[model samples]
Target: MKSLSVKLFCLLLVVLLTTPAVAEIVVEPEDITWTTDAGIVTFQIRFHNPDPTAWADEVSCTLYAQDFGVFLPNQNEIGTYDVPPIPPDSFFDVFMEIPFDQLPPPPEVHHPWDPMKVQPYCTPDDHWDGNVDLIWAGPGGAGTIDSHLGTLLVCPTYGASEIHVVTNCVINMTYTITGVCAGFTVQLVNEDYTAAPSPLAANWSGYIRVTADATVPIGTVCCFTVNFTCGGSTIPLILCAEACDCGPISNEDLDWGRVKSLYK
Candidate 1:
């Protein structure tokens, strides 16, 4: 019995010594950025794996937002990607674009509707989250690591605007600001006027004209502002005249001949 026990212990020690160690896998967000334009939101995210001996593959990401239903159509919320194998201690980037126009309009307000009261037109600004999962097939066996991309502010989309002018006339202009929080003031400032709606709130859209003397030299740049303020948070936006209408000698229309002259 003593000889048999010693042989069993030796066998167990040999098996343990020959087993390979599993590589530790880790996933983290390296960078995240977003831009909203023309009722569309585009997001770019970079993910990193810090494990020096593990390569990641079969990567996928899912985005989540509480207000996604309000701004995106049914089944338009999920996105997937097949990432190329990331060598140990490396990173990869992915991009996603969401269209807000496909979403259904806000439900109608009920009960004692008051025209004197302002109403929110869209979902309020909120935090957006995502999950990233990938596989590490090395050493011991196939393993997976799930990571959270953290939260980011999903600001409302602000459409593009341009100042329209014919020779020397400032055309009345309109801009739409969506997805701001409730009770926020939308202020516009430019060479023209610093004006806000009488009662500004989220999902506000209106028009402002150049208050300055409209008669300026052709090709002058006219910039306008849209400021959204809720509590202590404020979002400021600027729109240039060239966006709407081109001016004589418009900065964008400069000839190649003129560009060459500057280099000389």
Candidate 2:
């Protein structure tokens, strides 16, 4: 199962470059990573109005990558957003996102693999830079000025996220798909009891494994979730794995409770 946090991400592409002659466009929190790993990356775009007596209204903004370089994908637009009204001498905030799956890889890799996903896993130092523009028509007036879009740090990466079963001594443990798990597969592994024989051992150990098919783009993080029921009530087992792989429940993320107590 995927983390509940990943399922909640929403938002993606397009760029609009409008200059403000009198009014100005300002963006905050620069140098953001491509973040396709986290699904969608949303950043704030703030519009600035210099005039003290007038207001900046009807604001529109756009942001995108300028280039991903050789061997990687080249996308012009990343995402666009509309800015709210900015009072004179103040700033108004809006948002733009890093689109996923919308990116097209280079032609050489255009089969079932290339262009399969938006993540550009070409060079380890892939820096996707681009232009940004936020325009607004106000009583003061709008003008033009070329500005830098938020830097898209598309660092080339490889690896798969996996979920492992570390629990032991659970009889007939099973799982059910409780959410939409499109474009992925899950595996159930049963571990035989070594201390005791098969028929004699009532409870054993096992885990559900998830691996990314080669078709899955490199550095691409899959999305999905599942519920494991081990019959009756019991304490959640500890899970652990490499970065991005899911398995053991982290101490910070799990809520512990006493399922039962042993007495003399």
Tens digit per residue, CA lDDT, model 1, 62-84: 54322211111133343555555
Instruction: Name the lDDT value of residue 95 in candidate 1.
Output: 80
Off by over 4 Å in 2: 1-37, 68-75, 101-264
Each candidate's root-mean-square deviation in Å?
17.1, 23.6
Q: Cα RMSD (Å) between model 1 and the true structure?
A: 17.1
- Candidate achieving the largest TM-score: 1
lDDT of 2 by residue, 15-46 (tens): 12233334444433332223333445454555
Q: With candidate 2 superimposed using the best TM-score fit, by how many Å does residue 198's alpha carbon deviate from the native?
A: 75
Among all windows of 10 consecutive residues in model 1, the one with the lowest summed lDDT is 255-264
Clashing pairs in 1: 162-243, 162-244, 163-241, 188-225
Stretches of candidate 1 above 4 Å error?
1-32, 68-76, 102-264
